[model samples]
Target: MVTLAEVAEHAGVSASTVSYVLSGKRSISTRTRERVERSIEQLGYHPNAGARALASSRSNVIALMMPLRTDMYVPVMMEIAIAVATSARAHGYDVLLLTGDEGPAAVRRVAGSGLADAMILMDVELDDERLPLLRDSARPAVLIGLPSDTAGLTCVDLDFVATGALCVEHLAGLGHRDIAVIGEAPAVYERHTGFAERTLEGLRGRARDLGVRLLHRPCDPGYGPTSATLARVFDERPGTTGFVVQNESAVEPLLGLLRQQGRAVPEDVSVIAVCPDQVALQASVRLTSVSIPAEEMGRRAVERIVAKLAGDDADDVTLIAPELTVRASTGNAPG
Candidate 1:
């Protein structure tokens, strides 16, 4: 078998230098490091995982806790998970996927067993059950969503409040007075997930300030529920001329229903979405949207946890500013 000693010999460096290159405990010259890496690759040298862990006191793995619920936007969640895995790999670590169903116990188990060097949690609620355990554990951790109290936690997420307000401002600027919001599932609000509640809060506060009559409806995912929700929205506010939809599953359905009702988009009504850019571009009509930045959030969370593991204190909450893109679905309010 190709060994570390052989790689070191081939690279004309000491075994200790090769070890330092692998562990990153000490810096080696860039040229020397590159040479050692090339030799290791050419010789197909695979280090002993157990030996490396013992030497560094790190498993070189990161645990990612994701929600198991289907009610939320599954595509976005999946994209974040994929991004976390990819980014973690780039940082020389592997990812351990744990579902939210495991709850706080999972956090304790991973921390106690040294199964991972750090953790990144997703789908965080305002008062998440895992927060206390994370705070008490020695393992470094970062959250992909905010909590009610961010006292000592590292968090990375889009500023959902600003995102919501941006959507309203765009429509209101175009002379939209009566606007309706299609929110996530009722269970989402009942749980008081920070993002959902914050978005609603921003939307309502801005709507009031802009003198726009806003109606919000929590919608179940699918054609039937969305149809009923749309009907109720118009029934409650007959003059509604603009829409801010947070529910991704309901976007296409809402557009279809509006067409069926003979409402010409932008000419009769304007629509805006708070979703990933891909969703906006592929919709039946190109949608004006405030992007969720799922991949960026995931990448930032992993980076934060990795930094924390390296003895960097990462206790601050980082909120990515929201950016709205204009497209075919929005226009000046009707005459």
Candidate 2:
């Protein structure tokens, strides 16, 4: 195996200089940095994570907790993973992804074992049961979703309230008075608490004042359930001229159901969704929808986590806005 000493010798620099370049404790000139990087690439010298952690008391590993489901949206997860990995690598850190299936045991294992210096918790709920555990953990942590309180930990989330209102305002401007909201689920258990319901509330409030008839329906994350749910939504809300889908995971199933029902996109009914573009495109439906920067959110969350790990304050909550991307899926309401 190629060693750091080989890279340092090749780069005409001391081993400590190479370490400094790797750690970013001191800034090296671009020219020297490039030489070191080239040497590292040539030697393929990988740092010893265990040894590094033992020396610095920082594992340089940030734990990412996500909801585990075999049927979970792969693209969304990929985006988050890429962002977290990229952002952490830039700061000389690594990411360890831990799924929800691991549960409280996983939380205790990661926190108590000191395997990670910090953590970034994703898919948080308004009334998250894990919050108490995370708060009491030995490591510092940040949440990627909005929780009830932001008093102590760092958080990053989107403004779902504004997102909901924007969806209504956009449809209303298009002269649609009757619309239907398709979401993940209603807030019942810990299952349905996040930006989805908040956004729905925002949309409903705005739609009411505009005399827009809004029918909110929940679509199951699965294909069969979502298709069946959307079909029911269409049949029950016949007066609905437009549809706004807040759940990205169910967008594909919704599109499939629309096709099965012989509903032409934007021609017979207008469609808008709150999801990423890749998801919209993957469904082969060019949708006019609110785009969430999932990757960017992951990256920012890791950056904040790393900062907090480094004795820096990540006290503030960062909220990214949704960007509306109009595409072929939307058009004027049918007469």
Model 2 stretches astray by more than 4 angstroms: 1-47, 70-72, 185-190, 256-262, 282-284
For model 1, how does the per-residue alpha-carbon lDDT over 1-335 read when each residue is reduced to its tens digit? 77788999999999999999987889999999999999998988999777777776888999999999988789899999999999999999999999999899899898988889899999999999899988888899999999989998989989998988898899999999999999999999999999999999889999989898889899999989999999998888989999999999999999999999999887898999999999999999999999989899999998898888878975899999999999999999888
Top-TM-score candidate index = 1
lDDT of each: 0.92, 0.80
Residue 220's lDDT in candidate 1: 93
TM-score of 1: 0.91
Best by lDDT: 1
Candidate 2 lDDT, 1-335, residue by residue in tens: 77778889999999988999998999899999999999998888898778788888878788888777534445676787789888988987778889977777888898787799888887777877777887777688888878767777678877788788888888888888789887765432236566766787789889987888898887656787787777787688777778898766677777777787788887887889888777777666788888878888888888788777768864788888777888888887777
Clashes of each: 0, 0
Measured against the true structure, the TM-scores of the candidates, in listed sequence, are: 0.91, 0.81
Candidate 2 — what's its lDDT?
Answer: 0.80
Looking at model 1, residue 286 earns an lDDT score of 97
